[model samples]
Target: MITITTADAIIHTLESPEAIADIPSPNTRAALQAAYDAGHWELYEPPQAEPEPLPPDWPAFRLALLQSASFRLWSEALPATWREDLKLAAIAANAEALQSIYTHCTTLHSPGHTAATEWQQVADHHRIPITF
Candidate 1:
Protein backbone atom coordinates (compact mmCIF):
# COMPACT_ATOMS: atom_id res chain seq x y z
CA MET A 1 0.00 0.00 0.00
CA ILE A 2 1.10 3.59 -0.70
CA THR A 3 1.18 6.26 1.99
CA ILE A 4 1.12 9.79 0.57
CA THR A 5 2.45 12.58 2.83
CA THR A 6 1.67 16.14 3.96
CA ALA A 7 4.22 17.51 1.48
CA ASP A 8 2.69 15.59 -1.41
CA ALA A 9 -0.77 16.80 -0.46
CA ILE A 10 0.28 20.45 -0.20
CA ILE A 11 2.13 20.49 -3.54
CA HIS A 12 -0.78 18.88 -5.32
CA THR A 13 -3.08 21.48 -3.82
CA LEU A 14 -0.84 24.38 -4.87
CA GLU A 15 -1.97 24.16 -8.49
CA SER A 16 -4.92 26.40 -7.54
CA PRO A 17 -3.67 28.75 -4.80
CA GLU A 18 -6.22 31.50 -5.32
CA ALA A 19 -9.09 29.83 -3.44
CA ILE A 20 -7.12 29.05 -0.27
CA ALA A 21 -5.71 31.72 2.03
CA ASP A 22 -3.25 30.31 4.57
CA ILE A 23 -1.58 26.94 3.86
CA PRO A 24 -2.05 24.27 6.53
CA SER A 25 1.06 24.36 8.75
CA PRO A 26 4.48 25.98 8.52
CA ASN A 27 6.22 22.56 8.59
CA THR A 28 4.04 21.17 5.84
CA ARG A 29 4.48 24.38 3.85
CA ALA A 30 8.26 24.10 4.18
CA ALA A 31 8.23 20.47 3.10
CA LEU A 32 6.19 21.41 0.07
CA GLN A 33 8.62 24.15 -0.85
CA ALA A 34 11.56 21.79 -0.38
CA ALA A 35 9.90 19.15 -2.53
CA TYR A 36 9.22 21.74 -5.22
CA ASP A 37 12.88 22.79 -5.15
CA ALA A 38 13.95 19.11 -5.38
CA GLY A 39 11.47 18.50 -8.24
CA HIS A 40 8.97 16.16 -6.50
CA TRP A 41 7.44 15.26 -3.15
CA GLU A 42 8.70 12.35 -1.11
CA LEU A 43 6.38 9.52 -0.17
CA TYR A 44 5.43 9.40 3.50
CA GLU A 45 6.19 5.71 3.52
CA PRO A 46 8.08 4.19 0.64
CA PRO A 47 6.07 1.55 -1.16
CA GLN A 48 6.40 -1.97 0.14
CA ALA A 49 8.68 -4.11 -1.99
CA GLU A 50 6.59 -5.85 -4.63
CA PRO A 51 6.64 -9.62 -4.56
CA GLU A 52 8.93 -10.88 -7.29
CA PRO A 53 7.31 -11.82 -10.58
CA LEU A 54 7.05 -15.56 -11.02
CA PRO A 55 8.75 -17.05 -14.04
CA PRO A 56 6.10 -16.49 -16.65
CA ASP A 57 4.17 -19.35 -18.01
CA TRP A 58 4.97 -19.41 -21.74
CA PRO A 59 2.29 -17.05 -22.98
CA ALA A 60 2.83 -14.30 -20.45
CA PHE A 61 6.58 -14.43 -21.11
CA ARG A 62 5.95 -13.89 -24.80
CA LEU A 63 3.90 -10.77 -24.20
CA ALA A 64 6.54 -8.94 -22.10
CA LEU A 65 9.13 -9.64 -24.79
CA LEU A 66 6.96 -8.35 -27.62
CA GLN A 67 6.30 -5.19 -25.66
CA SER A 68 10.02 -4.49 -24.95
CA ALA A 69 11.56 -1.91 -27.23
CA SER A 70 14.77 -2.65 -29.20
CA PHE A 71 16.53 -0.10 -27.05
CA ARG A 72 14.51 0.33 -23.89
CA LEU A 73 14.57 3.99 -22.84
CA TRP A 74 14.44 3.04 -19.16
CA SER A 75 17.52 0.83 -19.40
CA GLU A 76 19.43 3.14 -21.74
CA ALA A 77 19.63 5.95 -19.20
CA LEU A 78 21.71 3.81 -16.82
CA PRO A 79 25.47 4.42 -16.74
CA ALA A 80 27.50 2.10 -18.98
CA THR A 81 29.13 0.44 -15.96
CA TRP A 82 25.70 -0.50 -14.62
CA ARG A 83 24.26 -1.70 -17.93
CA GLU A 84 24.95 -5.40 -17.41
CA ASP A 85 23.73 -5.15 -13.83
CA LEU A 86 20.31 -4.19 -15.15
CA LYS A 87 19.81 -7.78 -16.44
CA LEU A 88 17.68 -6.75 -19.41
CA ALA A 89 19.49 -9.33 -21.56
CA ALA A 90 17.38 -12.12 -20.14
CA ILE A 91 14.28 -10.12 -20.95
CA ALA A 92 15.52 -9.46 -24.46
CA ALA A 93 16.24 -13.16 -24.97
CA ASN A 94 12.80 -14.12 -23.72
CA ALA A 95 11.25 -11.57 -26.03
CA GLU A 96 13.23 -12.92 -28.95
CA ALA A 97 11.99 -16.41 -28.18
CA LEU A 98 8.43 -15.16 -28.01
CA GLN A 99 8.71 -13.39 -31.32
CA SER A 100 10.26 -16.49 -32.86
CA ILE A 101 7.44 -18.64 -31.51
CA TYR A 102 4.82 -16.28 -32.85
CA THR A 103 6.49 -16.09 -36.24
CA HIS A 104 7.00 -19.85 -36.38
CA CYS A 105 3.75 -21.06 -34.87
CA THR A 106 1.07 -19.79 -37.23
CA THR A 107 -1.73 -21.19 -35.06
CA LEU A 108 -1.28 -19.78 -31.51
CA HIS A 109 -1.94 -16.07 -31.92
CA SER A 110 -2.83 -15.06 -28.34
CA PRO A 111 0.18 -13.29 -26.86
CA GLY A 112 -0.29 -14.58 -23.30
CA HIS A 113 -0.75 -18.27 -24.06
CA THR A 114 1.91 -18.34 -26.73
CA ALA A 115 4.52 -16.65 -24.53
CA ALA A 116 3.84 -18.95 -21.59
CA THR A 117 4.22 -22.07 -23.71
CA GLU A 118 7.51 -20.90 -25.21
CA TRP A 119 8.78 -20.14 -21.71
CA GLN A 120 8.24 -23.73 -20.62
CA GLN A 121 10.79 -24.85 -23.19
CA VAL A 122 13.34 -22.57 -21.48
CA ALA A 123 12.28 -22.87 -17.83
CA ASP A 124 14.44 -25.88 -16.92
CA HIS A 125 17.85 -24.28 -17.42
CA HIS A 126 17.25 -20.56 -16.91
CA ARG A 127 15.09 -18.59 -14.51
CA ILE A 128 13.70 -15.16 -15.30
CA PRO A 129 15.55 -12.12 -13.91
CA ILE A 130 14.14 -10.64 -10.71
CA THR A 131 14.51 -6.91 -10.07
CA PHE A 132 14.12 -4.89 -6.90
Candidate 2:
Protein backbone atom coordinates (compact mmCIF):
# COMPACT_ATOMS: atom_id res chain seq x y z
CA MET A 1 0.00 0.00 0.00
CA ILE A 2 2.73 2.52 -0.97
CA THR A 3 1.56 6.13 -1.61
CA ILE A 4 3.18 6.79 -4.95
CA THR A 5 3.18 10.38 -6.25
CA THR A 6 6.07 10.27 -8.70
CA ALA A 7 8.22 7.82 -10.68
CA ASP A 8 11.06 8.47 -8.19
CA ALA A 9 8.90 7.20 -5.33
CA ILE A 10 8.07 4.06 -7.30
CA ILE A 11 11.78 3.51 -8.00
CA HIS A 12 12.59 4.01 -4.29
CA THR A 13 9.94 1.48 -3.25
CA LEU A 14 11.20 -1.04 -5.83
CA GLU A 15 14.72 -0.82 -4.37
CA SER A 16 13.62 -2.27 -1.02
CA PRO A 17 13.27 -6.07 -0.99
CA GLU A 18 11.65 -5.86 2.44
CA ALA A 19 8.96 -3.46 1.17
CA ILE A 20 8.22 -5.71 -1.82
CA ALA A 21 8.00 -8.75 0.47
CA ASP A 22 5.73 -6.85 2.88
CA ILE A 23 3.09 -6.57 0.16
CA PRO A 24 0.62 -9.29 1.18
CA SER A 25 -0.87 -9.78 -2.31
CA PRO A 26 1.27 -11.67 -4.82
CA ASN A 27 -0.74 -10.19 -7.74
CA THR A 28 -0.04 -6.60 -6.60
CA ARG A 29 3.68 -7.25 -6.13
CA ALA A 30 3.97 -8.89 -9.59
CA ALA A 31 2.03 -6.05 -11.22
CA LEU A 32 4.32 -3.41 -9.65
CA GLN A 33 7.43 -5.32 -10.72
CA ALA A 34 6.00 -5.85 -14.20
CA ALA A 35 5.22 -2.16 -14.57
CA TYR A 36 8.80 -1.27 -13.57
CA ASP A 37 10.38 -3.87 -15.88
CA ALA A 38 8.20 -2.75 -18.84
CA GLY A 39 9.51 0.85 -18.53
CA HIS A 40 6.04 2.38 -18.04
CA TRP A 41 7.36 4.46 -15.13
CA GLU A 42 9.76 6.36 -17.46
CA LEU A 43 6.89 8.24 -19.13
CA TYR A 44 6.03 10.45 -16.14
CA GLU A 45 8.74 13.10 -16.37
CA PRO A 46 7.78 16.60 -15.10
CA PRO A 47 7.13 19.14 -17.83
CA GLN A 48 10.13 21.34 -18.64
CA ALA A 49 9.65 25.11 -18.54
CA GLU A 50 10.43 27.23 -21.63
CA PRO A 51 13.64 29.28 -21.50
CA GLU A 52 13.35 33.09 -21.44
CA PRO A 53 14.11 35.01 -24.68
CA LEU A 54 17.48 36.76 -24.84
CA PRO A 55 17.77 40.55 -24.96
CA PRO A 56 18.36 42.39 -28.28
CA ASP A 57 21.88 43.02 -29.57
CA TRP A 58 21.67 46.78 -29.17
CA PRO A 59 24.94 47.83 -30.84
CA ALA A 60 24.25 45.84 -33.99
CA PHE A 61 20.62 46.95 -34.02
CA ARG A 62 21.61 50.62 -33.73
CA LEU A 63 24.15 50.31 -36.52
CA ALA A 64 21.63 48.58 -38.78
CA LEU A 65 19.07 51.28 -38.07
CA LEU A 66 21.62 53.93 -38.98
CA GLN A 67 22.31 52.17 -42.27
CA SER A 68 18.63 51.83 -43.20
CA ALA A 69 17.26 53.51 -46.34
CA SER A 70 15.39 56.16 -44.35
CA PHE A 71 18.49 57.18 -42.38
CA ARG A 72 20.62 57.19 -45.53
CA LEU A 73 18.06 59.38 -47.32
CA TRP A 74 17.97 61.77 -44.36
CA SER A 75 21.74 62.05 -44.27
CA GLU A 76 21.86 62.61 -48.07
CA ALA A 77 21.22 66.32 -47.48
CA LEU A 78 24.76 66.50 -46.09
CA PRO A 79 27.87 66.76 -48.32
CA ALA A 80 29.26 63.48 -49.69
CA THR A 81 32.38 63.62 -47.45
CA TRP A 82 30.31 64.29 -44.33
CA ARG A 83 28.02 61.35 -45.15
CA GLU A 84 31.06 59.08 -45.38
CA ASP A 85 32.38 60.51 -42.11
CA LEU A 86 29.05 59.82 -40.42
CA LYS A 87 29.13 56.18 -41.56
CA LEU A 88 32.73 55.86 -40.35
CA ALA A 89 31.85 57.33 -36.95
CA ALA A 90 29.02 54.85 -36.60
CA ILE A 91 31.36 51.98 -37.54
CA ALA A 92 33.90 53.22 -34.98
CA ALA A 93 31.23 53.29 -32.24
CA ASN A 94 31.58 57.01 -31.56
CA ALA A 95 28.99 57.40 -28.81
CA GLU A 96 29.01 61.21 -28.80
CA ALA A 97 28.47 61.44 -32.57
CA LEU A 98 25.73 58.76 -32.37
CA GLN A 99 23.96 60.66 -29.59
CA SER A 100 24.23 63.89 -31.60
CA ILE A 101 22.91 62.17 -34.70
CA TYR A 102 19.98 60.75 -32.73
CA THR A 103 19.13 64.21 -31.47
CA HIS A 104 19.43 65.78 -34.92
CA CYS A 105 17.38 63.09 -36.64
CA THR A 106 14.55 63.30 -34.16
CA THR A 107 14.18 67.07 -34.62
CA LEU A 108 10.64 68.23 -35.36
CA HIS A 109 9.71 68.76 -39.06
CA SER A 110 13.07 67.40 -40.22
CA PRO A 111 13.52 65.03 -43.17
CA GLY A 112 12.97 61.37 -42.09
CA HIS A 113 11.67 62.64 -38.76
CA THR A 114 8.96 59.99 -38.79
CA ALA A 115 11.52 57.20 -39.06
CA ALA A 116 13.64 58.73 -36.31
CA THR A 117 10.60 59.05 -34.04
CA GLU A 118 9.76 55.36 -34.59
CA TRP A 119 13.40 54.44 -33.83
CA GLN A 120 13.25 56.48 -30.61
CA GLN A 121 10.12 54.55 -29.57
CA VAL A 122 11.92 51.23 -30.14
CA ALA A 123 14.91 52.44 -28.13
CA ASP A 124 12.56 53.46 -25.33
CA HIS A 125 10.75 50.09 -25.42
CA HIS A 126 14.08 48.31 -25.07
CA ARG A 127 15.15 50.58 -22.19
CA ILE A 128 18.26 51.69 -24.07
CA PRO A 129 20.33 54.10 -21.93
CA ILE A 130 21.64 56.31 -24.74
CA THR A 131 21.04 60.00 -24.00
CA PHE A 132 20.12 62.23 -26.93
Candidate 3:
Protein backbone atom coordinates (compact mmCIF):
# COMPACT_ATOMS: atom_id res chain seq x y z
CA MET A 1 0.00 0.00 0.00
CA ILE A 2 1.21 3.48 -0.76
CA THR A 3 0.87 6.02 1.97
CA ILE A 4 1.73 9.72 2.00
CA THR A 5 2.40 11.31 5.30
CA THR A 6 1.32 14.93 5.14
CA ALA A 7 1.00 17.71 7.64
CA ASP A 8 -2.70 17.02 7.85
CA ALA A 9 -2.84 13.23 8.25
CA ILE A 10 -1.74 9.81 7.09
CA ILE A 11 -3.05 9.36 3.57
CA HIS A 12 -3.56 5.89 2.10
CA THR A 13 -4.46 4.82 -1.39
CA LEU A 14 -7.89 3.23 -1.37
CA GLU A 15 -6.56 0.58 -3.73
CA SER A 16 -3.92 -0.50 -1.28
CA PRO A 17 -4.81 -3.74 0.51
CA GLU A 18 -3.72 -2.19 3.79
CA ALA A 19 -5.89 0.87 3.29
CA ILE A 20 -8.81 -0.72 5.09
CA ALA A 21 -9.74 -3.96 6.77
CA ASP A 22 -11.67 -6.64 4.92
CA ILE A 23 -14.22 -6.61 7.68
CA PRO A 24 -15.39 -3.67 9.69
CA SER A 25 -13.32 -2.99 12.78
CA PRO A 26 -13.70 -0.23 15.38
CA ASN A 27 -12.50 2.64 13.18
CA THR A 28 -13.11 0.86 9.88
CA ARG A 29 -14.77 2.52 6.90
CA ALA A 30 -16.27 5.18 9.08
CA ALA A 31 -12.88 6.31 10.30
CA LEU A 32 -11.37 6.15 6.86
CA GLN A 33 -14.25 8.06 5.39
CA ALA A 34 -13.98 10.65 8.08
CA ALA A 35 -10.31 10.98 7.45
CA TYR A 36 -10.96 11.30 3.75
CA ASP A 37 -13.50 14.02 4.40
CA ALA A 38 -10.91 15.73 6.53
CA GLY A 39 -8.24 15.30 3.83
CA HIS A 40 -6.23 12.77 5.80
CA TRP A 41 -6.00 9.64 3.68
CA GLU A 42 -5.04 9.83 -0.02
CA LEU A 43 -8.26 8.25 -1.11
CA TYR A 44 -10.85 5.65 0.03
CA GLU A 45 -10.87 3.11 -2.79
CA PRO A 46 -8.93 -0.03 -1.93
CA PRO A 47 -6.80 -0.43 -5.05
CA GLN A 48 -6.05 3.00 -6.44
CA ALA A 49 -5.36 3.59 -10.08
CA GLU A 50 -1.87 4.67 -11.09
CA PRO A 51 -1.44 8.32 -11.96
CA GLU A 52 -0.66 9.32 -15.55
CA PRO A 53 2.83 10.21 -16.71
CA LEU A 54 4.08 13.75 -16.77
CA PRO A 55 3.80 15.74 -19.96
CA PRO A 56 6.88 16.26 -22.13
CA ASP A 57 7.11 19.86 -20.97
CA TRP A 58 8.08 18.80 -17.47
CA PRO A 59 11.76 19.43 -18.20
CA ALA A 60 11.01 22.92 -19.40
CA PHE A 61 8.95 23.57 -16.35
CA ARG A 62 11.77 22.21 -14.24
CA LEU A 63 14.25 24.47 -15.94
CA ALA A 64 11.98 27.39 -15.30
CA LEU A 65 11.88 26.44 -11.64
CA LEU A 66 15.64 26.65 -11.35
CA GLN A 67 15.55 30.13 -12.80
CA SER A 68 12.94 31.44 -10.42
CA ALA A 69 14.01 34.21 -8.11
CA SER A 70 12.58 32.24 -5.26
CA PHE A 71 14.92 29.39 -6.00
CA ARG A 72 17.92 31.67 -6.25
CA LEU A 73 16.80 33.45 -3.13
CA TRP A 74 16.33 30.19 -1.32
CA SER A 75 19.74 28.97 -2.38
CA GLU A 76 21.33 32.14 -1.11
CA ALA A 77 20.19 31.28 2.42
CA LEU A 78 21.85 27.87 2.37
CA PRO A 79 25.45 27.16 3.34
CA ALA A 80 27.83 26.84 0.40
CA THR A 81 28.06 23.02 0.91
CA TRP A 82 24.27 22.61 1.08
CA ARG A 83 23.95 24.70 -2.06
CA GLU A 84 26.02 22.11 -3.92
CA ASP A 85 23.79 19.35 -2.60
CA LEU A 86 20.76 21.21 -3.89
CA LYS A 87 22.42 21.58 -7.25
CA LEU A 88 23.11 17.86 -7.46
CA ALA A 89 19.60 16.96 -6.36
CA ALA A 90 18.16 19.25 -9.01
CA ILE A 91 20.07 17.30 -11.63
CA ALA A 92 17.70 14.38 -11.07
CA ALA A 93 14.89 16.59 -12.46
CA ASN A 94 12.26 14.31 -10.95
CA ALA A 95 8.99 15.79 -9.79
CA GLU A 96 9.60 15.00 -6.16
CA ALA A 97 13.13 16.27 -6.29
CA LEU A 98 12.07 19.58 -7.78
CA GLN A 99 9.40 20.02 -5.17
CA SER A 100 11.88 19.13 -2.43
CA ILE A 101 14.31 21.68 -3.79
CA TYR A 102 11.59 24.28 -4.03
CA THR A 103 10.51 23.60 -0.50
CA HIS A 104 14.04 24.21 0.64
CA CYS A 105 14.49 27.22 -1.61
CA THR A 106 11.35 29.17 -0.81
CA THR A 107 8.67 29.49 1.77
CA LEU A 108 6.02 26.78 1.63
CA HIS A 109 3.47 29.52 0.88
CA SER A 110 5.13 30.62 -2.34
CA PRO A 111 3.17 30.06 -5.49
CA GLY A 112 4.01 28.23 -8.79
CA HIS A 113 4.69 24.81 -7.37
CA THR A 114 3.48 21.71 -9.18
CA ALA A 115 0.13 20.26 -8.27
CA ALA A 116 -0.42 16.78 -6.86
CA THR A 117 -1.79 15.57 -10.19
CA GLU A 118 1.29 16.78 -12.03
CA TRP A 119 3.51 15.13 -9.48
CA GLN A 120 1.79 11.79 -10.07
CA GLN A 121 1.93 12.15 -13.82
CA VAL A 122 5.62 12.96 -13.87
CA ALA A 123 6.33 10.20 -11.43
CA ASP A 124 4.41 7.74 -13.58
CA HIS A 125 6.28 8.90 -16.65
CA HIS A 126 9.72 8.88 -15.04
CA ARG A 127 9.54 5.75 -12.96
CA ILE A 128 13.30 5.31 -13.01
CA PRO A 129 13.81 8.63 -11.27
CA ILE A 130 11.32 7.76 -8.55
CA THR A 131 11.84 3.98 -8.68
CA PHE A 132 8.66 3.34 -6.72
Using lDDT as the measure, which candidate wins? 2
Q: Kindly provide the TM-score of model 1 when superposed on the true structure, using C-alpha atoms.
A: 0.21
Report the Cα lDDT for residue 108, model 3.
33
Q: Which of the two, 2 or 3, has more lDDT?
A: 2
Instruction: Tell me the tens digit of each residue's lDDT in model 3 across 81-100.
Output: 66776566656555576556
- Report the C-alpha lDDT of model 1 over 1-132, residue by residue, as the tens digit: 212234445434443322223556776556655555555633345459999966545444435544555224433544553444324444465545444433433232222444445444444324543211
> How many residue-pair clashes does candidate 1 contain?
9
Predict model 2's lDDT versus the native: 0.56
Q: Show where candidate 2 strays beyond 4 Å.
A: 1-59, 101-109, 122-132
Runs in model 3 deviating more than 4 A are 1-52, 55-58, 94-132
State every prediction's TM-score relative to the real structure: 0.21, 0.38, 0.31
**Deviation from truth (RMSD, Å), model 3:** 16.7
**lDDT (C-alpha) at residue 70 in model 1:** 28
* Candidate 2 clash pair list: none
lDDT against the true structure, each candidate: 0.43, 0.56, 0.52
**What lDDT score goes with residue 103 in model 3?**
59
